[model samples]
Target: MTTGRDILRVTLRRNAGAISAGTLLLGLYQAAETAFPIALGLIAEHTLRERELGSLALSIGALAVIITTVSLSWRFGMRILQQASVTEAHRWRVRVAACGLQPVAGDTDLKSGEILTIATEDADQGADIIEVVPLLISSMVAVLVAAVALGLADVRLGLLVIVGTVAILSILSVLSRRIGTSTREQQARVARAGAKVADLITGLRPLHGFGGNHAGFLSYRRVSTEARTQAVTVATANGVYAGIAQGLNAVLATVVTLSAGWLAFEGRITIGELVMAVGLAQFIMEPLKLFSEMPKYVMTARASADRMALVLSAPPVMAEGRGRPSPGDDLEVEGIVFGGLRELKFRVPAGEFVAVAAYQPGAAADLAAVLAVRVPPEAYAGVVRVGGRELSDLPVAAVRERLLVNPYDGEIFAGTLRSNLDPGGTGRPVAEAVEASMLTDVVALHPEGLDHGVRDRGANLSGGQRQRLSLARALAADADVLVLHDPTTAVDAVTEQLIARNVALLRRHRTTLVLTSSPALLDAADRVLVLDGGAITAEGTHRDLLATDETYRLAVSR
Candidate 1:
């Protein structure tokens, strides 16, 4: 459960200046609006008694005008607050993205989708308090204004109304505590369900292949049902709190009316005073409801705040170490080791084709990650040097700019073929890259060509097509060095041969690292590095390794 102080802190931290001013203006307008009804009741009593023509009519008209002005002001103030809250949400989302993009050292575990959910969903919730809190405070002011009007009518009636209002408010406050707990639990359940659904959908193919559809779907259904149940719990609690508050207000209204009538009968107050007290009841009831409703809103807002905090608090995946490396274009990995790879050293000339075959594919994948600067060199015990400079010693952005690594599982985002092939091209020509990646055949087969629309993650494209499109994207990047992991794994042998040949031709003079067990790709490489047990056990041509290295032979064996 979140406290009032926590919700206030989040609102102020996000948009303090705008929210504070909006709240003050709203409170002032509500105070005036609350007084309008009482002023109308007094005017009515004076008109009936004295039958005044000019003065009474003018006063009543002026009060009506004031009520109109207050209504307009409240509307405009609400607009300003809503706009400010939305702006705060937008700014918070940008901050979340900035934090997520901080060096990988501190952000590895943060999922992109999770950050998106936090920024939009959680931030919106946190901002909701900006609109709700001021109205809640104004409601209390309305209740006070009613108390003052009722007091002028009859002291006993005023005391009864104030005490009853306080009691109703107290009940509301108690119920609000329960609201916060339920809201927090509900939000957690929803987030968990969202993450699970996303994971299940993304890995649907693998799950189906493993024949775990029934079990996986059943588990997902269970999680979904749990989330629904929590939502129902929250809704039930909110409804009960509202019902009780409304019921108490009705009871208070009856008690106040009966008390006012008793006072009038005893010759303690006038009939006009009885009418005034009845009129004040309506004013007090609405604000009472508003005040009561606020706690539930505040509770929801706090739950959202906590969710946003989770995203903000996530650490980046990588850290920038001290010192800067000299800028250059060569690629080198000294004492590189991770996963199955032990302490190994290797360097690629500024423009060369190097193929690596590892007995354990995980070792090759880890080494590729280290070489591409995706995984920190420190995670293993090594130095990955680019352009004769250690990668860790250079800014991450600069390293990323000079190098491109396209893993086999790279996503093909929903977009036209042109957008998928050349995302950052900004309408630049992608024909060369498409042709070089042998995607000319793919385009020729499609009537839409580069304009063909791909579904999310290329659900519309075949596995091999997705891989080829990924390769085309990398080719279009025109990076200095490109590392590809099992790029042709999903393609047929004939297609693989064509892609392998095209990849080598396209990257003729560029520094390219291909992690593969394919003989065709290895045969095209200028040199082959055989990874066995852990370290690079042999370095030679593809033919040489096949003849001399038992581990490489076994790994490359069909």
Candidate 2:
């Protein structure tokens, strides 16, 4: 429930010390820079009044000290600011990444690409706010100090400097608001384009096979073009802002210099005061320009912070339970109705192998998600219990430890075969699971065996190989209740048969549920349940259903 402003406050508080130190140093640097011109004026006056080498050396020495201070202060100030900015970004990235990993209680509005962008680019932009505050403070300190020094030399000149600075900042602030609006639009458009590109890349192979590659490419092209247009608009606004800032600064500096020259001609002020006034005017521009640009950075940071807050504030789809589940193998669903399932009732006794062949493809996936605890209990009507314990009452960790639901399309990360298979590195032997999932051929093909490299999402492997590898990974978990959806769909009939036999043998005396229409898997089950129209229409052996049920036969034929 935290707001974007709260996020900004928290970040600033966390990095306050570093930010303060940097700001102090920057202010000192600006002070030293302002002193340089004053020193030059002093040198000029002293040269005219004393005409002594000793006096000239003292002034030159003072100027050298000022120059050194400016150099050192600027270096340390920048170091601190940059380090703080990066560290702040790292904190946000870690937080956003952790939030993304949590289970959502409902549908998520964010896409994978958008989440990635938030974690990286948006996080960095949010952190940049830490520098903005300090820079603005230091720039103001420089401008105010210059104005005071100018006033000390000549009252009118000092008033002019102060008035001009305020006017310039006010004009830029309005322009900066426009830039802020455009920048936010640009960021959103870029994120949309990024999401489209990511979708295209993830489904590239399938798109090619379906001859839909051109359509996807055209879609991405349209989104990318929009992003480009937005980017150009942002750039144009920024360019105008920068040009105005520089032009205004130049105009103000010229006015001050001309006024000082006229005052010296009128013999109203000494030559040294005139020199100092002109130098102060020129020096003021740097800080004035920085002051004018601060508003834009602040606005951009606010937009980025808002995006980050959206991700961090999302509610978890499933709440964690504190109660433990009983150690029993029985899984029962009584009158469950959710998504594509309606009034579905079923039970698989301890150590029983049951298959639920859903007529609709989406129904099977929805059923798997429900069993996997991916959906919250409140979303469904009835109850799912493990070992006679209501699933909602049992701790999520406890249920997950005992039951595993492997989806049809599982992700394969970039790593060696062994690492992907045994990601937890629990030291469980993979040989058994490998053999059970019929991945022996895949392992044998690579000379390195399980150590063979896998590309991202297993892109280097074939469809069958990827499916088998995923199956092997699931089997390797060694959970008590394993539910698999279409585990062998991508494999050949002969391989599927072998896999079914091996899976039955490996999981003998263990509770298992296979949600599939694969004949080999259905035949291997001790009992098969025909689920049609969101209900279990029939329950019998695979052969009995095929022989007596025409609807079941038609479904399995596909």
In terms of lDDT, which candidate is strongest?
2
lDDT over C-alpha atoms for residue 328 of model 2: 84
Instruction: List model 2 lDDT by residue over 444-549, tens digit each.
Output: 9989999999987787888888999999999899888999999998899999999999999888899999999999999999999988889898999999988999
Provide the global lDDT of candidate 1 against the true structure: 0.77
- Give per-candidate clash totals: 15, 3
The models' CA-based lDDT, in order, is: 0.77, 0.89
What's the residue-level lDDT of 128 in candidate 1?
Answer: 82
Q: Count backbone overlaps in model 2.
A: 3
Model 2 misses residue 384 by how many Å? Answer: 2.2
TM-score (C-alpha, index-matched) for candidate 1: 0.90
- Looking at candidate 2, the ten consecutive residues that score lowest on lDDT are 101-110
In angstroms, give how far residue 458 of model 2 lies from its true place.
Answer: 3.3
For 1-558, candidate 1 gives per-residue lDDT tens digits of: 333355458667767777677777787787777667667766777778888688687877789787886887788789888998888777767876776555354443435556666677877887787888778878887787778778887777778878988788788889999989988888777777777776666667668888988888998899889989999998999899989999998888788878877888998887677777777776677778888788888878877777676656654445565555455567887886678878888888978999988778888777767766666555778777878777767667777778788887886788889988777766534777787667888899889989888887777676678888888888888788888888888778877777778878888888898889888899889999877777888899988878987877777866
Off by over 4 Å in 1: 1-14, 98-113, 156-162, 208-210, 321-325, 371-378, 425-429, 445-447
